[model samples]
Structure formats: C-alpha cells, structure tokens
Target: MESSSAAQSVVETWSAEATSLAGAFRVVARHHPDDIAVKDEENVLGYRELDDLSDRIAARLRARGAVDGQLVGVVIDRSVSTPAALLGVLKAGCAYVPLDPAYPESRLRHAVGDCALEIVVGDPKTVDQCGLGALRVVDPGAGHDGGAPPAGEIEADASAYVIYTSGSTGLPKGCVVSHGNVLALLRHTLPLFDVGPADRWTLFHSACFDFSVWELWGALLTGATAVCVPAETARAPEEFLDLLERERVTVLSQVPSAFRALCRMAGAAAPDLSLRYVVFGGESLDLDLVGEFVRHTAPRPPVMVNMYGITETTVHSTIRFLTGQDLDGKGTAPVGRPLPHVVISLRDRDMRPVPAGEAGEMYIAGEGVAKGYLNRPELTAERFLTLDTDDGPRRFYRTGDLGRETESGELEYLGRNDQQVKVRGFRIEPGEIETALRDHPTVRDAAVIAHDSAQGATLLACVVLRDGEPGRPAEAALRRHLATRLPAHMVPRRFAFLDDLPLTLSGKLDRNALLGLAGAGRNGRP
Candidate 1:
C-alpha cells in the first residue's frame, strides 16, 4: 500500500478468497449445522434447515423451468422464507430479485415487467396480494424444500442479485450485484468486525434496502448466526427491544431513524441486553442526535460504527467506530477507512484525482464494485466509469456524493453536487437550502424540490409542521425568514404544507413524487 498523503493512514489491499454467495452459506452449514441461522417469533430455522430449504426452493424452481441468466422474483416479508427464496434463485442459476411485499403494486409490477420474471417464490397464504399471472408460483406448501447439491464451482462474476433503487430521473433502475462483489465485501469486512461463530447478527434492515444485503449474508459468510427480526417488529420500539434481548443479539445495524425510535423505550422498557456491536447507516447522522442516543442508552456498546456506501458498491465500503470518549464532545463521526480489497478516491469532473482536503466527487473502486446495471448499458457507462488513479486503471463508481479529505486524512461528508438549483447563472445545492429550513423553529422536516418550467427551474419548499406549528406563515414572512439564513435566490418560491413528506418504500424522502405534485399544482389541476 502507498500513501496518498503523508498525514493520512493508508490501508492495504490484496487478492483474497472470493466465491458465490451460496457457497458462503455452505461453509456455515457444514460447520454450524445446529446453530440457529434464522428466526422470527413464530418460526426458527437452523443452518441445516435453512440450507435444505434453499435446496428445495432451487429444485422447485428448476422443476418449473428456471435456468441460469434468467431472473426470478421473490415477494415476501422479512421471515425465515426469505433466505430460502434467495438461495433457491441462486441455486437454480438465475439471479433473484427481492420485492418487498408491502411495495405499491405499480412499483412491484415494474420489477416484474423489467426482469421478465416467471417463477415467483413466496408464502401461498399471501400470494393473492401479488396478483400476477403468466407465472408459476412456489409457496410454503411445496414439498421437500431441501436436499440438492450446490451449484458447483460457479464463477464469481455471476449475477447474485438485482436491487432497484429510486431513480432521481424518475425511472427506477436495478443495479446488478455480482457474486464476486458480495464475496469481496464479506471477505474484506469479516476481519474488520472480527465476526466468528460466537457472534449472533441481528438482521435489522429492510430486505429492499442495501444494508440488508450485508446484514443477511455477511453473518452467513462468517459462519455466524443471522438472527431474524421481522419487518413489523424491527421498526416497533418496544417489540424491537424485546427481540434484541430475547434473541441475544450480538451484532446490530440500523439507520439513525430507527435509533431515534428505539430511544423512546429508554427506562425499564428498553432491551435488558448487552450487544457487542451496533452500527448505523442509511442516512446522515447528526452529532446532536447521536449524542441524545448515547446519553439515553448510558453504558453503550463498544462497537458503535458509522458506515457509508450505496447499492452500486455492494452494501457498505467504509466504517468508523466510536468509543464513549469520542461522543462526550459532540462531533460528526468520520465514516472510517475503506474495507479491504477496496479503494476510495476523490476525483474531479474530468476524472483527475484531487489533492487532499479539496472537495470533489467521491469515487469508489474495489473488489466489491458491482458489474453494472441490468439491461442498462448506457446508465452503467454513465455511473460505473473508468479512472486512472496513481495505483492503476480503476473501475470506479462516481458516487454522486460530494466529499473532502481532512488534514487528518479522513473523508468528510459534503452534500451531493448535482442535487442542483440554478439562480443568477450559478447552480446551488438544494441540500444547503433545506439544511437551513430544518433549523426553523416551526419546522419538523423540510424538503426542497426543483421545478422546471418554460422559464427554467425554481425551488419549492415542502415543510412538515412541527408539533404545534403556528398554522402557515405568510409567504412574504417565510421569504424574510429564509433571507436571514440564506441568499435571496435560495429562498423557496412556494411553501406547501404537508403533515409529513412522502417517502419511498425504503423510508427515504421521495423527491420525485413531490416534484410531480408540484407540477400538478402549477398547472392548477389540484
């Protein structure tokens, strides 16, 4: 490993073992067949049971005409059946597309249509809700969901899964994750976390979100138990704590939003548990919020990590841990260094590496970088691109995120560069405007959406009223309020009142839908 700067710590990278996702599961099954691999309140399955069910699912898929290179859809909740459905698809040699059972019909239909999925595996009890025909369905009633040989010696480059992310341009596209990418991620991360057979990982993320990709399979790869938390209970404060204590959870990862919710059960209701590790991702974490949680939880776990990554680079790339001392004085925690087999580079517009401490687009190149998007070659080229860093020809993903390296050599988060607003022949980031709005006394959550009309685009602010908001402020007064904090051009042109901002299935702000509503109002259609 070579240093990019004299002050920064350099991480080493080298070739390591990589294999198909299913192959990783077999290692656990062989070593810990009786260890509880997955569990929900109603059901539980050990490594042997999970592996056999996956084999049966694969056999069922093969019986119904599934083949490699084809895609199969799995519509289910976070349950024992999920791993089996995923394994079956992989075992049958086709990539599995996971669909949240609760997704809006239109969104679910999009993946089905785009992937041309024919065989769907789910619980027969709830298959009616999916309402798709021209496809064969496999449910829990199907016999012998286990006992088939592993798909032998498959290439690491095979498509392991296809995850669809909300498209900023308004068309959701599926990013194809390869076996090599996942294998690389697990291999690199295993040592960082020091996970082993003694650990029990809490599957805390939604199946649709990329974090679940790590939470579900990461434990399996390391020969640890993946204790399941059903989606319903995972989000509920009281129930979630109970699950953690009851299951004896050792490893946990979730979003700041979840931590906020769990903080409600502080006193005697919170889990009477001791976790070895607790990690957070999925959204920006404010130092203030993290402080509140640490203070409330008291004797916190040793492994409190802030991780960062997107679906295009497997699940997570960087991780940083915090000790009790680190949070005593509130400060933004740095997302730690990159995992093994991965390299993080800061590059400018023309793909040239930037000097340390200069803000630029964050580029990620590594063993776990996804091959590309499914059937989206143009987008694949646009996002997953090439760069010539000092190391070598690197296949880098232009992580739309803007970041700067500190004098300490740690990467600092700046917002997104193309999340744009144009005024006076200059483009500005709306995140800056929203950050100011969120500080208003009467605002709970604020989102700014850019509207493009014949006269070009303007920013509109959507505000969720605080608990006791003083009704709606006069438009002029609102502008005056913003003027004190931001430049005149950055003031929101129109303010819309919402009890809550719309969110995607993954619990992220749905800016696309907000802009659509704004357009309808502009035309006086509402």
Candidate 2:
C-alpha cells in the first residue's frame, strides 16, 4: 500500500512538470548532461551538446523569420543534425514538418505549400538538389554565435510536429500532434519498459514516419542513446544486423515486414547482441515467422512486444508482450491492451459497441489522439468524433482499423475496414486469404489483392516461396492448400510469384505496387 501511494505521488508530480516535450527533454538534459544523447555515423552528441546545438538552431530559425505557432519544414537526412533541427523548431515555438529529401520534388512542394512553410532547416546541398532552393533554408551545420536565444515558452496543447500520411484523396494530409499528446504517451508507456541511460535505441524509420518520433524521443526523454541508422545500412539486413551487434542496441523497434528479412538472416548466423526488447509496430505481426526467430535466439531471447497504432494516435495505442507460449496455440497475433491513459472501443457502423468477440471499427480516445488533420476540416470532422460514454462526453478518433476483443480481454487486430471488399455480393478480407497462403509449407510471404478484371472483381494472390523449397508449386496446388482453410469464394483465382514483396521506404508493404504486379499480364497466372 505504501508503494502504491508512492507510485501515485510520482505520477502526480510528473503530470505537473512534464507538460511539453521540450520541457521534458530539458529536464532529462539537465540530469544527464555528460551522457551520450545521439550517435550517428558522422557525429556523436552528448545531451548537453545536443541541447546547446538545438538552441543555436532555434536562434537561427528565429533570425530567419520563424514565428510561434507556425510550421517549419525540416528536410534533413537522418543524422545528429536531424534531431537537433526538429528540437530547434519546437524550441522556436513552431511545429516541425519532416520533408524527406528522397521523396519526389512534387510531394515536397505539396507539403511546403500545404503547410505554408516559411523557414526550412536542412543541409544546404540537399535543399538545392531537391529543388527547394526557392524556400528560405537554414543550414543546421552553419556557425552560430555563442549567445543562443532562450527556448520558446510553449503551451502544452501547442503542436509539436506535423507528420504527413497518405490520404484517400490521393494527396497526403498532415496529422498535427501536440506536445501534451506525446508526453502523455511516454508517461504512460515508458514505465512498462526498463529503459535507462545505459540503453541504446535505433532510429530505424524515416523522420517522415511517426515511428521515428517515438524512436527519437523515446531515447532522448529517457537519457538513452539514439543510434541513427544510415539509409544504406537500413536497407541491408546483414549490415543492419552488424549495426545491432556493434551498437549493443537494447530496445529495437521494427515493422514486421522488415523484421522478417532480418529473421531470415539471423537463422543462418545469429549475431551476438544485447537486445532487451524487440517492439513490433507499423504492421501486423506474423506469429509463425516471429516464432521461428524466437526459437533461433535460444537461451535468452529478448522480450517481444507487438504494438498497434497509427499516425493519428501519436505512434502507439495498444501494447502486448509476446512469448513462446503465445505461439504454441493456433498462431494468433494479439495487440494486447491499451496504454493506461488511452481508451479503446470497438464500434459497429452505427458507432455503437459491438458484442465481445465481434469485429468492429476501433475508436481511440485520450491524450494520444492528435489535434486533427491540418487544413482538412471536413475530413477531420468526419474522422475525429465526439461521443457520450459513462464518463461523460469525450472526443475520439475513429480508427478505420477492424478489431475485436479476445477472450483474454486483449484486442486482436483484423485488417483495415476499407480493405474489406464485396465481390459477387459476398464480403471478403484479403488478409484472410493472405494468411492461408502463408500457412502453406513452401510460401514464405504472401499478399492478396482484389483485382478488377475483364470478368469481374476477383482476388489475386502474390506469393514469395521459401528459399530452399523445391520448384514453385502450381497455381492449382496453391489454390488447393487455401481451399482447405478458406471458403471457395475467399480463395484467390489468380497468382503471381515474386522473388520479394515490394515495400515502401518506411518498410511497410507497398499495396499499390502489389496491385500493379497483380494487373501486369506477365506476372499474373490463372
């Protein structure tokens, strides 16, 4: 009882002081001034150095006409400068919008114009190469005077960053996440893990993705070292594994698709490492693949955690810790429970709660919910909603994801609601068929898409066979394997064999590219 009371007091104290991200980071920097904060290939920055550098960057932005409550574009590659630039923007009282230099020029222009960016912090050479020289650019590496301006006094509700996500309208929409939202997420979730100054975390994803937000702050706020993975190393499984072994990364986060490749490499030669937690997010986890990887890790495997979240939910909403026992049963991927501060409800089309086991659209409410989409009022109104609960009126973000409560009270994630398709008056989920394909002995990875053919809308299966598997199985044989597990209408009619599935820059499956492969005459086999 005394311990419980002490925990309550700690929470209350943190709630009062840790209002904004910049403020929270300042507290950490003060405590761990000499501790390493960031480590990139080119540079290593201690907490005090990082703090001082960000202040100088903030001064540069302020001198370049950046004002409070405005959006500042950050178009830098992943490095020591990247975090400093983002922190600088927040310090200047402006939200940072990450613009990937690798993205198409048109996309960068769209984001710049959409957010009305006045000052962009990036490498001067990258700005010119990306043809963003027209905008006012502040080079983070440029020399600055010793007298740095004071950090901005920002409100807790003020926007911290704007991350752009692919929209249904073909254009990208920015999700505005406030400083308080992020602090709430960290305050509730960090206690679950044993993170500390000695730990090392990887910034594996691009800054454009919200997962990077968690990776960056998850380390800085906790005084852990944020290891910046280079683009080339991130693409190569062997090199990335080498990095993990060399850096002694303790908390590793990955999307399942990318991790699958690494698992295959680990099967051949397991590297010596000190990974404490392997957190999976960005996509659904394939239990069979992860189970195999766990077996290979042997005596002391890292704690495997699967997290379900979206860009609008400030990185993560649900958390589940996995074990060998979880894989023993009929392989099921459960995303566990919501964070203490988050509230999740599975609702039907009418916004009413569904029965315990029935699948429904997920509604997430709490401090983790983003403010809303930037410059998209109508769409924001449609997605972000208010409803009356037992606790009174509360605002919730209607996650288009489909999920159901398990017998254990944990949430089981079904695919996206929009991914559900109707063909010949029968509703089907492509993920169901994909899972069936993956269950086959020879198939390593599988993706199923509904294709509009000359006949009608039919399902197309794209598969990657196991490396040492005999010759490719015939389409009919694959169909027979799926038929035993799925209904007749659910089995895919056509198949496409690929050496590897296409993936986006962020490592998620590239659905559009998969659809293109399905439609291509040479790839599809009836």
Model 2, residue 337: displacement in angstroms?
Answer: 0.7
For candidate 1, which ten residues in a row score worst on lDDT?
6-15
**Clashing pairs for predicted structure model 1, backbone only:** 52-146, 56-145, 56-146
At residue 480, give the lDDT of candidate 2: 86
lDDT of 2 by residue, 1-526 (tens): 0123322333344456667777777778887899999989979999999998898988888888887888999996879999999998888888999999889999999999899887899998898888888889889988784445555457889999999999998999999999989988887877677667778999999999888988999888777899999999998999999999899999899998889888988888777878888999988888887788777777667888899999898999999888668877544479999988899999999999899999999999998999999999999999999988889988999999999998989999998999988877799988888888888888888888887888788888888888976434557788788889988889877788887888998889999998787677435654
Candidate 2 off by > 4 Å: 1-16, 145-147
Give the Cα error of residue 54 in candidate 1, in Å.
1.3
How well is each residue in 335-423 modelled by candidate 1, as lDDT tens digits? 76776677888878887778878988889999878988888899999999887766768799989888888786777777777776676
| Model 1, C-alpha of 222: deviation from truth (Å) | 2.9
TM-score of each: 0.85, 0.96
Residue 296 local lDDT, model 2: 70
Per-residue lDDT for 56 in model 1? 84
